[model samples]
Target: MTDAFRFFLTLLDLAGLILLVLYFVQMGLAAVLPARRLRFPAPAALKFTFVIPALNEGLVIGATVETLRALAPEAQVVVVDDASDDDTGRVVQALAAQDSGVSLLRRTLPQARQGKGLALNWAVQQLLNRLRIDGADLTREIFVIVDADGRITPELLGEASSAFADGRVMGAQARVRIRPSVLSLAPRTLSGRMLEQQQDMEFFIIRHLQHLRQRWHSVGLFGNGQFMRASYVHEQFRQGRLAWPDCLLEDFASGVEMRLAAPDHRMIFLDSAVTQQGLPDLRRFIRQRARWTQGAMQCLGYLPRLWSAGMPWLARLDLSYFILGPWLNAVIVLSLLTQPFRWAFGAHGLILDPLVSALITGVNVVLQLQWVARYQREHRLNTGQVLFTLVSLPVYGFALLLSLPLAYWNHFSGRRTWDKSSRHVEPGEAVPSMNGD
Candidate 1:
């Protein structure tokens, strides 16, 4: 029995070493390979339609409206109030009454918070109805999706429009980060503040990697701050495929569909275009990410399509690795942690022995620190914050690693309800939008 267990442990170690090496190699290639040179035309005088799908978001709705209005006074803002029993609809209705550019689409029971996908679909129909009445040209406009507590600056509008000038690119995703008030954090709320900074670093790393994937002309949309060409979205909605994604992670599923719907249709990641979001409670964060994992797992249904020769091999390989992440994470964590026990029990030649694990951990941290040093100007992490984040890597990483198992539990238990993320955007929590390097 002991020998059998040791053999399994050795197998896990081998898997972990392979995954670790593959991960770093891919990241290195992405970092070192010179970006493909493709010049986009200058930013057009593009009109934008901002869609905010809200459910009981009264606290932050008004501020969201004000910030967006400040950024683009001429852009059309549509607030889809999904039957919030609170004053969410009322707040937006008043704003719509006051501002000519702002419009409110109030939805009641039988169609409320059914899911964000359906709520967004409802808003799209209303937008289409409004546009048809006004004789607006869909081809000349862009559709931007923003969360209720998210903020965007006007500068991103022009930069994103320039990306869409290629005509082949269907979507553009902005770099998203969390920037809660550091000074206003009370002793009890310090954990939340710390978590927010960690999230900011996470976004910085993810956005940079996605930017690298652009060299292969392969990119995907994020849930918040997704900008799409209006004509394509309009056609999809007309065909009834754009809105009714069955997965709880509608944003991710929609992104995959966009990639598979046509080879010419592609998304781009814009590091320069940035969006700031506030962190929810830690408990809600787990629920949110578990849903994300399941959503990603659900996208496994699209594997056959992604593997088709129609898609680029680079994108196909990336998707396969991403889908295997949940399982690999468990192997990686166990292999790294159990090496000492295995060695003490007469195990030998393990791929992830204690020394090797330490080496891997050291290199990973050094790479992360390099990212911090390069973008410290944009992230604004202090000495204490940096130290705390360095120490907290395991905690943050384990949090995601656990999600794979949680997703399995959700699937096996037949619990597929969408638990909306709790919103707590207090006065000081809304971060002012800024441009990224």
Candidate 2:
């Protein structure tokens, strides 16, 4: 039994080692490889339609609409109010009445609040119909999805349009940054500040990884700040496979499908950013991340299609690794949980030798420090914030680790409803969960 446990520990160590090596190799390649180039068309020539999904987002939806309209006056903004019992619909309707470019799609009871994917899909259909009536060139039109709390700079639409100039590119995801003002709502404490900084750090790392993935043609969408071509969306609509309403991570599932749909299909990571409000508290953060984790696990259904997509082996490998992450984490968690038993049975030796463990630890620390350095440089963080971030990263990591087991439990227990996050709920108020996705 002792030998068996040792073998299990050894296997876990090897799996973790392989994952670490893969991460290093990808990061190295991304750093050394030339940037994936694309042609930029005049921003004036591109027609953008921004789709914002709202569910009881009365507080911020007005600002989001106003910001997008201010940034791109010529662009059409469509806000789909998913049966918000609040003034969400009225707020958007007022905006629509004030500007011809703004429109509101109100979903009623029974069909409302299904999922974000369905809301987006419904908005696209309405957009296509309106465009068709105007005899618009669908092929040249771009559809951008923005969350209700999302804000984009003036350069966002223009920068995003640059990718579509490359005929091969079908989708583009803008870099996502957490807005600092939202964190003001959190209690004034070191932990609260750490939460905000760590979220910023998380998005920065995500952007960097997306840049790395551009080489592998495996870039993903974050729901907010995601852009897709209208013609491609039209094609999906006609084929009855537009947006996935059931997947918890509808954005990710749609991304995978986009890649598999065509050989030349490419998704780029945009240099422009869309700033979003972060969860002000840990409870909301965990709920949001658990939903994301479960969504990734649900995406395992795409494995058969992914393997047969005829992508290069490396791309397939990268994607497979991503979709299979929950299972891998589960194994690692099992290893951690069983360590006490191994110690009890006198079978607790180092999974890797002290020297090897130290090397891995050093490499991880260096890589993380590199990320922090980049974040600090890009965001102009002071020394104190940098040091605080470095210290709090482990806590953030442990928080993410906690989400995985909860996600797995929820998945197995058939808890698939969407638990909406509230930015201004009072002390003990429960965030509401809606039907369907």
Candidate 3:
């Protein structure tokens, strides 16, 4: 074996070891970090306007509206139907008629306008205009944006409203729980578990790190349930030039803009405010992840601006993490694949002993289990759902690997489209059983 090949294998092994250690460390942090309780204000005197952007959500629209009605009866609820081919409009109209607080708005996309960002911009514009005409104070009205598939308990809304009362808090992000579904294929089951791991890590670990640095500015805004001050959003819209910036990742771009424009405006991740949403089936899940990867790469230019714009050390670190994390995964995978070839051809047999590698792998498994247990407990996931995580790791790893090239290709080719995911439920219907899969 050549010395060069041996050196390369050694480097690869070291890199893998480091990543393995980091993964465990991240999991440990997630497990032991004391949960922060958001101080929500009394809801009696506060006014909230819930804004939902629906594009073919006829199935889930009714249930969401009803949930909101039960949770925030006094608050105004506006449903923006984004020219759905389905009966989304009719459902909202019926719901509006039944509940006076519920208002319906139909947005016919003009020739040039496209994407959820556009739909959101139109709805928010209408909201601002209505409030202005009504002579309502901008600072007093809370605006909540929920995804069409979003399921919220009554307590979630109240908790979100309470966070708004903090004055400095410009936005509050709710905890996202992926409702588990049964899948026949092992790959599909693994993919779902990987997603569950991501959610747990985001809420428990990543979010804490963000808060500690005072730069916890962004959340899963791709309509992961969030509430913001109407006035703040309006101000951002005007300053940002384009309403949603013609970007595939509108939520992320908006977060960057908000942080830059208002440094002190805190965005809280309300642990108690939970939203139940579906995980994509294996195929759609890959597509969704590819879109995110592409979007993140395209927005790399914004990182320096975010960093230089008076963000705290922790916030800056978080930004760097996202910008480089995907590539790091790619590197780790490549290193793992090439290690054996190098060992056979090179002088260095293996830098790390098999026992050490096994120990590292075992640690990784334990950390994953800890996260899965915490996630299942908090979200009330069933035993089958909990077991799915254990089964999905390799499948997710493969998906991650496949998504890298596709994301880069789309980025350079300038292929940005509103690749919307389909909703699985109908208005007022129970969540579909995963067992059918």
Q: What TM-scores do the predictions have?
A: 0.88, 0.92, 0.81
Residue 52 lDDT, candidate 3, scale 0-100:
84
TM-score top scorer: 2
Residue 194 lDDT, candidate 3, scale 0-100: 65
Q: Which digits, one per residue and each the tens of the lDDT, describe model 2 over residues 267-375?
A: 9899789988766567777888899989889889788988888787777888888888888888778877877877787675345778988987887788888888888
CA lDDT of every candidate: 0.74, 0.80, 0.67
Candidate 2 off by > 4 Å: 28-34, 40-44, 182-188, 424-437
> Deviation in angstroms for 436 in model 3?
28
- Order of all candidates by lDDT, from best down to worst? 2, 1, 3
Clashes (N, CA, C under 3 Å) per candidate:
0, 0, 5
Instruction: State the lDDT at 161 in candidate 3.
Output: 62
Tens digit per residue, CA lDDT, model 1, 297-396: 6677777778874777888887667766665676766666677876677675464468878988887777777776755666676887677767656667
Ranking by TM-score: 2, 1, 3
Q: Tell me the TM-score of model 1.
A: 0.88
Best by lDDT: 2
By summed lDDT, which 10 consecutive residues of candidate 1 come out lowest? 428-437
